[model samples]
Target: MTGGPATPPTPRPPLGPELEVRRLGRFDYARARDLQQELVAQRAAGEVCDQLLLLEHPEVVTLGRRTPEGAADGLDLPLVEIERGGEATWHGPGQLVAYPLFLLPLGRRDLHAYLRDLEEVVLRTLADLGVEGERREGLTGVWAGGHKVCSIGVAVRRWVTWHGLALNVSNDLAGFERFRPCGLEPGVMGRVADLAEVPADDPLLEAHLERHVRGVFGHR
Candidate 1:
């Protein structure tokens, strides 16, 4: 889903620099998107602080501004046009979706640099678990052996980031088969458990993911 064009950065909030993280469980994609829109609106209105929201969505496919037509594959998976920048991708119970609402200083409106920082967070998390991951040129996700383990699509309004990244933790790969992931071939999709040899049903995997995410985005 593609959001509108970047807006001019507003003055920073008075709160000392900090990152706010919230964990939401099993939210619907539409609802989550709505929440993001509301947050962006609130930020524009100067009614809220910079924050990051993490959550999982029920099975849903999202299409971005550049979403490929052939990638839909005639499937009926619910599609929501989002403000984030990217192509089509899947989200389900086992996937982790992070939406960061941050106010970038006026001169710091660099989308490419922000994307690289977000990718680094995921790469560092995967590396903590012994999964070697890297980024491919022209792509915005982390990959393990040519297969994408994480997908990132984001939107910024007035220099405040909204929609964020999604990492496949233990979701069913069958749903992913319904679309060309991030407009890439089916062979490019991957999951955390598939790479780590951990059981998809294991709660420990989620715990570890949460820990790593906290470490990566924690207040310093």
Candidate 2:
């Protein structure tokens, strides 16, 4: 009776790229963005291995490529303009933001395929937490019971991805009302805690996400 199919979903073929996962707890939004920029360049140049940057940002609103002018007009949170895909979205404590600095190899340069892979990882992670997540047709994030619990928007530079997805865990979702997220109504946003029983101090959310990412992408 969860959100997705009763039977387990099919596993995706693992990309098995070497990945370095870094957890930066309570990081600043601007600083994290800057770090991703640096890492993307390094990864593109083969100076560093592919990485998965996991962390939470303080309250901030970001405008992506598809965001309309003044989309963040009335939000009191610090606003930042970014190059990621999608519209305005919020990030704060209790939400996990993952920036995967992955350089697509010769045969894996398909953006659509990469996005679906990310969705699958989130779906599997939700399953681990007893929350069944599903994908809405033409939508980019994972949803449970018709509410979107994750928001994904990525940008690629020289086939290396930077801006990535954010999964709402226990964040204050009131700020989502200030603007549309991915051009959808504010009420469309959902959190894992709302659907599953997540202990306030539990580390399982992050652990599940990391494990699923590695499992789906075949990363070590």
Candidate 3:
């Protein structure tokens, strides 16, 4: 069964203002999670404003709250169990990952709205790249045509958010072959590389996305 109980949104604690943006160029999966925990605590303690971590992680498969019954039965690559609100998804090179450890807006901690806002960042980002990104109603991530170009899964603590999105910019997407992505069957995914204009490589791509997210979420 899917994890996560229906919890009411709480008012955001009065903390330091302004969302801090950090780009970790290239990092491993475990390291990213470690930093998220540290930052989450800081946000909860009012020692820091909201933080947005933009980086790319090495090949890894992450399980979300609704992961299928036997999804993790077998896997050769690294598998991580997270508190996010989705099914299984993968992360690796060429995928832009954003971890927004944000203090939820006061009285606006509605999870569904927050999710749509996250998709807005990517949808706008894709539009800037000359690609048509659309959202499939009843589904979370941004889709171009019918293919999913982005995947979003998030977890919250103390009314603060962690874990964000993974956009397929230039990766081979081999990591997705492991399971039914977001509970969907295989071969339904799309990559930015498939577009005529490939996004800037690595560190550059991270910065490009960072701008759009900040703008969408009011950090700009």
Candidate 4:
């Protein structure tokens, strides 16, 4: 019941020479962030392979490092400034957050390229469900029509990366109304259920997301 009707059980990619997956649920951003920092330190010390920490954050609006003043204009939600890159966005239950901690060689640290690959993972998942999407110019997420279906904001240090993307599954967008999502034009946020014309809890949707994620990062 993981992959949707259109999604096949695709083969997982080999995580090259270093990669790990830490499955967690219902975790807060603060704890997740702490784990990310710890994992980064571990990788630096060669104590563990690069890892992907998956979890859901409590309802919160996070403003990234480069976010400008008023980027969250008109939003009344609880806000927290974090170490990630990009503008402001919301995270809550029902949404899936992925934090990939990897070490890229100095010149190999391409943040833009990394973001595109992450977007493609979501886009491909959506495509399998007959939902076509594209990357908008000057924007950092996957979009269906004009609504943002996935949000991307990442951070990099010395060629290592942490804090990845968030995809709205069945989360309440009402909370999104409290802010201009990712500092985009108001009302630009969206969910998979909204575009797929199906319930977010549909067994197929969950399966597809999990499979797609495994597929995306399976290759280290």
RMSD of 3: 4.5
CA error at residue 156 for candidate 1, angstroms: 0.9
Clashing pairs in 2: 16-218
Alpha-carbon lDDT of model 4: 0.72
What are the lDDT scores of the predictions, listed in order? Answer: 0.72, 0.83, 0.78, 0.72
Q: Each candidate's root-mean-square deviation in Å?
A: 5.5, 3.9, 4.5, 6.4
Q: Write the per-residue lDDT of candidate 3 for residues 28-98, one digit (tens) a residue.
A: 99989999999999999989888989888888899998997789678888899888889999888878888
Off-target runs (Cα >4 Å) in candidate 2 are: 1-17, 199-201
Top candidate when judged by lDDT against the true structure: 2
Summed backbone clashes in each candidate are 6, 1, 0, 4
**Weakest 10 consecutive residues of candidate 1 by summed lDDT:** 1-10
Error of 1 at 89 (Å): 0.8
Q: What TM-score, to 2 decimals, does candidate 2 have?
A: 0.91
Single out the weakest 10-residue window by summed lDDT for candidate 2.
1-10
- In model 3, the runs with Cα more than 4 Å from the true position are 1-17, 199-204
